[model samples]
Target chain A: MSRIKAVDILAGGFVVLIGVLAIVESTSFDMGTSRRIGPGYFPFYVGVLMVLLGLVIAVENLWTRTASDFGWSLPPMRSPFLILAAVAAFAVMIERFGMFPSIFVAVFLGSLADTNTSIWQKLTISVAVPAVCVAIFKYGLSLNVDVIRWRP
Target chain B: MSDFASNLALGFSVAFSWQAMWYCFVGVTLGTFIGVLPGIGALAAIALLLPLTFGMEPAHALIMLAGIYYGSNYGGSTASILLNLPGTPSSAVTCIEGYPMSQQGRAGVALFMTAIASFIGSICGMLIMAIFSPPIAALAFSFSAPEFFSLMVLGMVAASTLASGSPIKGLAMIGLGLILGMVGRDLYSGLLRFSYGVDQLYEGLPLVAVALGIFGLPEVIKNAGQITGRTVEARSISFASMWPTRDDWRRSWGAMFRGTGLGSFFGALPGTGGLLASFMSYATERRVAKDPSRFGKGAIEGIAGPEAANNAAVQTAFIPTLTLGIPGDIVMAIMLGALTIHGIQPGVSVINNHPDLFWGLLVSFLFGNLMLLILNIPLIGLWVRILAIPYWVLYPFIIAFICIGVYSVSNSVVDLYVLMFFGVLGILMNILRFEPAPLVLGLILGPMLEENLRRSLTLYRGSYTVFLTRPISALFIGIAVLILAWTIYGMFRARARRRAALAAGGE
Candidate 1:
């Protein structure tokens, strides 16, 4: 099966499963005053609607001419690898550099795939955006953080 | 004359403080940056800065936050039009016509036109706010719980109109979102609904984490492996100057007017707010266009109308929020936090109490729009250059930034675990062709909805009919029912057509 169809089936199945579970689980509770719909009442209906909708989606995809948009193509993986690395680095160094430096550094080095960027421009951006962000957010606003300690 | 003069002078006095001006500049700049980058939204930007804004004076902090909110709305079209990637949910309307324009190599014209259109929209919305805020606030104050619930239902039904792929899929996604929203603690009894005994799901999902995971990470994953080399056979179109031609002005002015009209109405509609404004604008533009076929094929009207509507909606939505103390949307919800932190009660009393805040905010909006126009028009070329950055280098940083931003929100490692878990769920959501925006909207509004629904029941002596008996509530519910009926009919017809086609094929 195509990925789109595959996912549709799985999602449909999951929705159905959730609906069944909600129905089964909700039955144990006292549905309580008819004047006020119990907590389970809204959820039970929502679950039923989900299952019905999922079935419709699944059956429709099976019978209908749905477009296959999710094509599988593995382009160069360098960017993905780098992106993961940058995320890891940021997650680790956030406390050290603070939100400003951490974000600027991640966005800067993370944008390194462009052949158009000069060393000077990169250096300027790398230095400038973080500093500006720090000045504006931390010092100017008096936001408390220990990343770049300033004594005036 | 004396009152007008005093208010104007006082507004300028409050808005012109050096610190306020600097924050405005910072807010506009940050707004532009986020707008240029796909998947980073104004709401996320505002939420991240909420903590930082805690220290500044209420007016200055809110001015900056509000600037970022609308500034990003203005700039979001740059990437969508030029790069075929929407920078925010609101800008997806641009992508229908914008990506095609880029493919035709009129990316520059599209970018320029959108920027101009945004400025016009911002100016118009501000004018509206300046002239009519008190009346609008007075109207908004009349809404009660039943009316609010009806409004929320209207928003939920309208989720299908969010410029999405399939109507059934869209509605189904909304259902899914509502279910996901119900996964946390039950508001009335304090009992868990769908927690499955996991402590992480106790307080429900955070809006930022869910937004980042569902919308942000999926796009990154999709784009991570795709090559972005532009191969435009069509010659690129450039304006002789920054100024739009008289014809451009004529075409766009109508769109701006129409957008403002739609924006004002949709922005006031409690739950969806600016989201519906952008969608409604695009749909209206499509319906009204002389050549309807040109939409989704590089129509400048497509860009102009929706961009205008989105920004206008952002500004006008504040009227209801600021005056009523009820949030019009999630961004306003975060701004509510800012208000409470600054010790300001956002209600009828705000105008009675702090005239500086009310007038200053109004005037700062005018100043902020001017600053945004000056800031974005010249920076179009610089923004386009951002697309030149390679995926390998950019993707990791985006992922890392998402991680850090989510983690920093509460200084809780538990939130990180919650984020990662939802990140997986988000990827699955994408795979299932579900639009995540409504889901995020649901999660944000769920708590409020529960609280109000219960309060209304209590008020009515446990009578459910109270919702329908109230005039405003009845009207809103009536509209919601009509919308739902229309959607159901539409879905049935589409499904029947598919079945007919299948039978005709002798299957």
Candidate 2:
């Protein structure tokens, strides 16, 4: 199969899985009648619609050939992972270490995502970003968060 | 006339306040800053800044946010003209002619004309809003649950079909969004539907976290290291050289007016926005031009028309948002979300309840456009410099801001986790070629859709025919049906054409 077809199948399969899950979860609720619809009514109907749509999308490639390149190319994982990690770090550290240190750590980690940056450039950005953030969020915006806290 | 004059007086008085004016300035300046940069759109910018508005009055907050919406429209064309990068999605059409114009060293003229076009579009759209909104609001006042339900259905259908990409994928995304929106407590049954043991989700997903994760994170990931290292030459823009020639002016004036008209029509539609309006304007301009060959080669009308269309769409988008309480686009959805957060309900009654908000916002559009015109023309150098800022320096701060912004919303760690989750989902959606805009719309409108559905059914004693019985509701549903049928027909025709081509090639 072509790469584009593979992508379509994968996407359609994922959507179908979500639909099945929704349908299964919704069945646990009372499936009330059309008159006094239960909580499951909307989810159940929407799930069925989703399943139909997914099937159609999956089979669409069989009948029609498209010239546009829909080939799956791997996105650079480094930046996405590191940026996500940076967010996670801030989430984990903000309460324990406080805003300033958490922000500094997050910026430092995020700055590493760009492989093109020099160590000195990363360091400068890490320091500069947090300082400006502290000025803006803490001093300027007056957000009710601790700038620095040693206690967990 | 007297009532109109009095309303205008009230609007001017409220909008002219020092506090309102300052925030307007702040919002437009920040909007221009982000709009000049590629990748970060007004949706993401509004999501990022939503946390900061917690302290302000809802009226001022809305004015500022409204300023950002249209200000970004003005600023979005800059990068399109100079770098072939559309600063916002609506500006994508501008890049066709704009980049060519820049290549021919008419970048300054293109920038000037876009600003002027944007100004004219915004003014015309705002006037239409002022003149027409009252009647529209009055008409919407009679709409009940059935009408609302039908309107939302039409909106979803329109949004999915009209948006760029396959209609099927768009529908699937909307379905997914509707499912995701079911994560909170069920209002009718008092049962928590999908919260999975987390009490933080009782109020449903944190919109800021979801938006930032879905829109902002993916952007930061995609553009990392790409935006930096390019320097815009400062010598390119001379104030005296920015003026367009007489011939350019003559061609652009009519195009701008026509663009505004197209934008106003599309913008006032509940589901569509500036992106559709801009593309339509571009298509219309191309069709009407005496020599269509000049379009992709620095045609002034190409830039003027679409820029005007987008700006006009930005202004008129508020019509449905404020009157009908249905958002005209994703940004308006967020704006409505902001209104809800501030304990203000948006709908027909909003005009009656808060004339100051409705009128003041209208007046602010006038002032904000004036401010944007000044900011865009003379200070082009500052924005160009902003474009030169390295991504390594920029994305980190964006990361920090996203983290803090999400955290500030509820002071909950769960929201941060939600942000991370949506970020991953967003990247996955990107890979699958799904448009996130419809999903966001679905998420915003999902609960409302369900509420109205249940209410209408209950009111009519479970009769499904109530939807078709009401004239307005029936009209909306009929339109939805027609659009869906037309789209399916188009899809089938295209498929048949493709098959024929394939068979011919084989023979």
Best by DockQ: 2
* Tens digit per residue, CA lDDT, model 2, B1-507: 999999999999989999999989988998998898887889999999998898899889999988888888888899888888899999999999999988888888999999999999999999999998988888888999999999999988999988888788889988998988888888888777777788879889999999999999999988887676666766648888889999999999989999999999999898899999999999999999999988788999999999999999988989988988888988998998899888888767788788999999999998898999999999887887777776677788889889999999989989999999999999998888888998998888899899899999889999999999999999999999999999888888888998788799996
Model 1 chain A worst lDDT run, 10 consecutive residues: A143-152
* Runs with alpha carbons beyond 4 Å of true place in candidate 2: A63-65
Which pairs of residues collide in model 2?
Answer: none
Candidate 2 interface CA RMSD, Å = 1.3
Q: What is candidate 2's local distance difference test score?
A: 0.89
Show how many residue pairs clash in every candidate, following the order shown: 6, 0
Per-model DockQ against the true two-chain complex: 0.24, 0.76
Backbone clash pairs for candidate 1 read A79-B392, A83-B395, A83-B396, A87-B400, A110-B393, A110-B394
lDDT of 1 by residue, B1-507 (tens): 577678778889998888888888888878887777765677767755665565688888888898888888877887777667777778888898888877776676677778777877777777776666666556656877777676666666665543355555666666666666777777666677777777667777665566665656556655653644543233333344446657767777788778877877676555456667888888998898888987777777888888888887787777656765556666776676568658996655565477788788878887888888776676666666665565544554455546655665566545555555565676666656666656665665555565567667767877889889999888878887887687667667766887888799999
Per-candidate TM-score against the hidden true structure: 0.77, 0.98
Question: Against the hidden true structure, what lDDT does model 1 obtain?
Answer: 0.68
RMSD, every candidate, angstroms: 6.0, 1.3
